[model samples]
Structures are given as C-alpha cells and as structure tokens.
Target: MLRRYQTAICDALASVDGGSFCEDMWTRGRSGGGGCSRVLQDSTVLEKGGVNVSAVHGTLPPDAVTKMTCHGHHDLPAADGEGLQFYAAGLSMVIHPRNPMAPTVHLNYRFFQIFRRAPSERSGTNECGGEEATEGESLLWWFGGGADLSPSYVFEEDCVFFHEKLREQCDRCDPLYYARFKRWCDAYFRNHHRNEGRGIGGIFFDDLNENMTVSPEKFFAFAEDGLQTFIDA
Candidate 1:
C-alpha cells in the first residue's frame, strides 16, 4: 500500500512538473529491510521534492518501549524485560515549488506493528546477523499520518482552499475527523519557543487503531483519499 502511495504521488508530481525523479535505493543493514527514494530537483514547477517509502523491522531498545508506554500504549510489555521487536512501513513526501507564492507541502502516512519474540527466537540470529524474530506474533499495531502546507507568504484564499479540501476529504470517512485532526494539526505544528504555528493547518492524526472506533481497512481508505486530496490541491 505504501509503495502504491509513493508511486502515485511521484507520478502525479512528475506529470505536473514535466520532470523525472531520480530513484535511490537504500538498505537498513542488520536492522532488516530497505526502501526507495525518488527525488526531483530544479524542475519546471518544483524547486526540489522527494517521495520516499520504507519498510523496516528491528528490535526496539528498552527506552523506546518505555516511551511508547508513556504515550498511552499501556498494552506494550514492560521495558525492563527483553526488547520488543517492531515492523514499520510508511510513505513520506515534501514538495518545494519553484514559485515562492506556492506553499511547501509535506505529507506522511505510516503503519507500525509491535511483537514479542519467543524465547528460542531471541537466542538466535538470522543470516544477516540480525535477530531472528521475524516470525514473532504481532501484539499491537497502529496507523498515523498527516498533510500540511507551509507557504513562504500566507495567502488567505489558498490556505482556505487547502483546509476546505482536506476537511471535505476527512468528512467522507467521518464528519468528526476534520475538526479533531484540524485542531491536532494546529497544535502539533506550533513552535513552542516562538509561540506560532508553522503554517496554516490542514489535517493531522496519529496512533489511530481499532480502539479509535475505526477499523484498519477504514483508516487505510482514509489515508488513500488523503493522498488524492494532496494531488488535487
């Protein structure tokens, strides 16, 4: 799914700018997995931009598990015990248009799963020297993502249009999603030291799962619509 998102977004941008993206593939080594990054520079419509996708798996350190627990993932195992293994996949993109009048846009959508390794698996290593916990049973999973615009100079009409389109997209899934995520976007993008928001808000959400009153399939659909919204906007 993430790969599909990356391809769609990159293709849309390339079509708009009439420029091709250079692809770069990278590996995570012992951590397992790799990803591809597509970047375009000095394009007709865009100054610079990249759409990236990655799927990585590895053990999370004790401190990382503690942080997740503190963030309300109480179901996670205790951090004092063996490290929890995890798998994460995501698509992220940022576009900087050649024209300053156009806003720099950013979008990211990701899925994460946590697992506990069996005792036998924990004691072994894979061919790559990474832990042999690839077959561990998943204990928790979630989806997270957001999209926002940041113009060098604010254009009220443009900002309003962007927010309205995002709101419309959110409404298709759940009427409450727009308001809730709008507030989250405004709050999340704020610069505490400067006491100002980074940009005119669009929509933001995180840690979304079945507990949030939506199934994983529903969330995936919403995320897919979000990418379409970005392309349209």
Candidate 2:
C-alpha cells in the first residue's frame, strides 16, 4: 500500500513538473527489509521533492519502548527482559515548489506493529536473523499520519482552501476526525518561543488503532483518501 502511494505521488509530481524522479533502493542490514527513495530536484515546477517508502523490522531497545509508553503507547510489549520485536512501514513525502508562493507541503503515513520475542528468538538464534517473531503474532499495532502546508508567506485564502480540503477528506471517514485532528495539528506544530503555529494548520493524527472508535481498515481508507487529497490540493 505504501509503495502504491509512493508511485501515485511521484507520477503526479512528474506529470505536473515535466521532470522525472531519480530512484534509490536501499536495504537494512542484519535487521531486515529495504526501501526505495524517489527524488526530484531543480525541476521546472518544483525546486525539490522526495517520495519515499520503507518497511523494516528489528528489535527495539528498552529505552525506545519506554519512550513510546510515555508517549501513549502503553500497550506496547514490554522490552525490559528481552527487547520487543517490531515492524514498521511508511510513505513520506515533501515538496518544495519552484515558485515561492506555493506552499512547502509535507505528508507522512505509517503503520507500526509490536510483538513479543519468543524465548528461542531472544537468544539471537532465530533463522531470520532475530528480526522475525517465531509465533508471528502481533501484540499491538497502530496507524499514524498527517499532512500540513508551510508557505513562505501566509495567504489566508490559500490556507483556508488547504484546510477545507483536508476537512472534507477527514469528514468522509468520521465527522469528528476533522475537529480532533485540526486541533492536534495546531498544537503539535506550535512554536513555543513564538507562541504560535509554524504555519496555518491542516490535520494531524497518530496512534490510531483498533482501540479507537474506528477500525484499522477505516483508518487505512482515510490515509488513502488523504493522499489523494494532497495530490489534488
């Protein structure tokens, strides 16, 4: 799904800019998995941009688990004894248009899963190099993502249009999503020193899981629609 989004975004950008993206493939050693990075720079319509996708799995250190717990992922598998196994995949992109009037846009959508390591796997004896869980059972999983615009100069109409488009997408999934995520975007992007947001807010959400009122599948659909909305906007 992430790769699909990557392709769609790159194609859309290329079509608009009449430029092609250079692709770089990379692999994660010993841990597992790999990804492709597609970038376009100095294009006719875009100054620079990249659409990347990656899937990786490995063991999480205890400290990392602690931080996640503190950040509201209290259900993550305990990493105290043996580090918890983890899998993560995502699509991220940022676009900087050649025209300064165009906003610099950023979007990211990701899925994360945590699993308990089997005793035999904990000793670093797994055939898959300790990256794969023997039971293949996920203890917890979640979806997170957001899209926002940052313009060099604020245009009230542009900001309003961007936000309205995002709200429309969010409303398709859940009426409450727009209100909740808009507040989150505003709060998350606030600059403490300046006492204001870095830019006009769009929408942001994180840690969406089965525990929420919506199902994971619904969130996935929301992400898909959100990506399309970004392309249109």
Candidate 3:
C-alpha cells in the first residue's frame, strides 16, 4: 500500500515539476522498510526541493525515539512497546522562487501507521506477530497531512487567503480541525535558531486516518481543493 501510493504521488508531481527527478541517498531503516527520496535541484519552480516517500516498519530504534523526542515529540508512541508497523507516503517540497517576490512555499501530505497487529493480523506485517497481535486484535489507524506557505515579504492577504482556504477544507472535515492545526502549524514552523520563523506561517498536523469521522475519500477531495487553492493563489 505504501509503495503503490508513493508511486502515484511521485507520478503526479513529476508531471508538474518539469525537471528530471533524482532519488536521494537515504539510510536503511533500523526497524523495517525503506523510503524513496526524490529531489529536483534548481527546478523551474523551486531551488532544491524533495518529494520523499517512506514505507518503513518495525520498532523504532532507541536513537530514533530520542531524536523524535528532541523535536518535541512528546506524543510519539514508545519504541519498544509493541514495535510499530509504520508506513508513510507524502510529498514535501519547498519552492524557492527565482523571484524573491514570490514567497517560498512548503507543502506536505502523508499517511501514517502505528502498532496494530502481527503479520498474520495485518497483511503488511512480517511473520513475527507481537504479543498484542497474538491476543487477536488490530491496531488503531489514522492520518495526518497539511500544506503551509511562507512569503519572504509578508503578504497579509496571501497569508489570510492561504489559511482561509485551508480553514475551509478543515471546516468541511471538522470545525475544530482547522483552528487546532492552524495554531499547530504556526508554532511548528518557528525557527528557534533564528529566533523567528522560516516564513510567515501555514499549517501542520499529524495522526489522521481513513477511519476519521470524515471519510478518506472526502478528505482526499478536501486536500485536493486545498492544494489547488494554494497553487492558484
């Protein structure tokens, strides 16, 4: 599922970037699967951007857990608990427009996974069924994806429109969804090193899935609309 979806997103983005894509060098996962990292250097619409897709699983190593924690991952599941079954596919791109007037744009949308069941319980897992899987139960499923904008020069209208379009989509899913994620996005992009931020502000979130109150198909439509609005603006 992760590989197929990664291919789909790569195909869709390749058609638009107007540049040959190159795979990035990524370290093999300590736990399980690996990811395909693609980049477009000095692209027509970007400076150096990446569209990465990772389909990895297994328990996150201790180092990995520590790294995530350092990034304020106070909510990431434990590493040794049940050996999470992970799968993520998303497009992350930063368009550093030749015209500095055109603010830089960063967008990412991905699917996620957590510990659910053993290989037998879930079709994608390995033969080693963990203690939880042996108990005959499935893991909880969810999703998380969003797009944000950062203009070098503050464009209040652009920022407002960008957030508003995203808000509309969020409202369609759940009224609280937009406000919550919007605040998260604003805080998430802060550049502690610079004591400022990478750009003006956008949106950021995690833990979304097909089983949400809003169906996957509906969310897909909303995501597409949100992306289109961002591009069109």
Candidate 4:
C-alpha cells in the first residue's frame, strides 16, 4: 500500500507544476531496512514538498520501549541492556504551495510491530534480529496516522468540502470516527503560543488498534480511501 501511494502522490504533485521530484534512496541505521524520499523544491505551484516511505527494523534502545507503555511490554526487553526487535513502515507527505490560496496539506499512514528477542540475544549472547524473527515471532502490532490541512486564509467552501468528504469516508468504517478523530486532530495541531486551532481539523490518531473496534484491514482501507480522496480535493 505505501509503495503504491508513494509513486501516485509524487507523480500527481509534480505533474501540475512541471517540476520533478528527486528520489533519494537510503538505508536506515546500520543493518536496518531502507526507504525512498521524493522531494520537490522551488516549483511553479509548490514552494517545497516531500513524499517519503521507509521500513526500518533494529534493536530498539531498551529505554525507548518503556516509554511506549504498550501491551506485552514485559515480553520485550526493558531495563536489560539488550533492546527489543522492532519494525515500522509508512508513507508520509507534506506540501507547501506557492500561493496562499492553496492550502498546505499533510498525510501519513504507518504500521508498527514490536517483538521480543531471544534471551541469549538480549544478553548479547546471540545477535539481535539475527534471522530469529523470520522463524515466526510477533508480539504486538498496530496501525496509526492521519491527515490535516492548513490555510493562511480561511475559505469556508474549501473547509466544508474537505471535511465533508472526510466525514463520508470515516462513516464508512465507523459512524463516530469522523467526530472522534476530528477532535483529536484539532487538539493535536493547536498553536500553543497563539492559543488557537492551527487550522480546520481533519483526522488524527495514534495507537489505533483492533481494540478500538476496527480490524487492521479496515484501517488500511480507510487510509487508502483518505489518500485517494485527497488528490481529488
């Protein structure tokens, strides 16, 4: 899904301005997986824009695992010197248009999974994520992210159209998702110094899991629909 979106979004964004996005393929820390970043700078329609996708896996620092406070933490390394094995992949994009009339938009969709390394691996007795993971070990996993819009100047029509389209999609998954995630977006993207909302909220969520009464397949479908609708908007 992320791979598909990466190409589609970059192509659509650059096609309008006749500018090209530079593809930067890179590897993560050490042996971690790699990803691609597509960026466009100084275009006719956009000031700066980027669409990045990555899948990284490594032994997470033990301290970092504790902060997450997620389920099945005891199974993962915490105070021990060795860290837990983890993997994450996602597509994230941001667009800043040349004209203030064009709203700034951002979208991100991601999945994260963490699992325990063998005891020997934790003690440095065995290398972390050393082919042991592929044998079939998965502790916990979930999907998260959202999209938002910001406009220097308010346009009631655009806001209405954007939110309405989002609401329609959210309703397809759950009747309450729109209002619920809308409030989340508003709170998440506030101008703390100014004491105001950043812009009309769209949808924002983190740590959305099956416990939220939706399946993994449903959330991925929802994210795909959101991205598709965004290009149309």
Best model number under lDDT: 1
Clashing pairs in 4: none
lDDT for each residue of candidate 3 in 1-233, tens digit (9 for 90 to 100)? 33344455555555666776687644344334455677667777556666565544455455666576577555555556454444444445555555577777777666554443434443443222112222223244445667776677787887777777777777876788887887887788788888886576666777555344555666556555555555555
TM-score on alpha carbons, each prediction: 0.87, 0.87, 0.63, 0.85
Task: State how far residue 128 of model 2 sits from its true place (Å).
Answer: 18
Q: Summarize candidate 1's per-residue lDDT along 27-127 as a digit string, tens digits.
A: 68754666788999998999999998887677788999999999999988785466888877788999999999989999998888887873333435432
Question: What is the Å distance of residue 167 in model 2 from its true position?
Answer: 0.8
Task: Count backbone overlaps in model 1.
Answer: 0
Model 4 agreement with the true structure over 137-218: per-residue lDDT tens digits: 6666777788888999989999999899889888988889999999999999888999998777789987777563655788
lDDT of each: 0.82, 0.81, 0.58, 0.76
In candidate 4, stretches whose alpha carbon ends up further than 4 angstroms from where it belongs are 70-80, 118-136, 212-214
| lDDT assessment of candidate 1 | 0.82
Count of backbone clashes, every candidate in sequence = 0, 0, 6, 0
Q: Candidate 2 at 200: error in angstroms?
A: 1.3
Question: TM-score of model 3 relative to the true fold?
Answer: 0.63
Q: Write the per-residue lDDT of candidate 2 for residues 61-114, one digit (tens) a residue.
A: 888888988998877656766677777778899899999888899899888888
C-alpha lDDT of candidate 4 relative to the true structure? 0.76
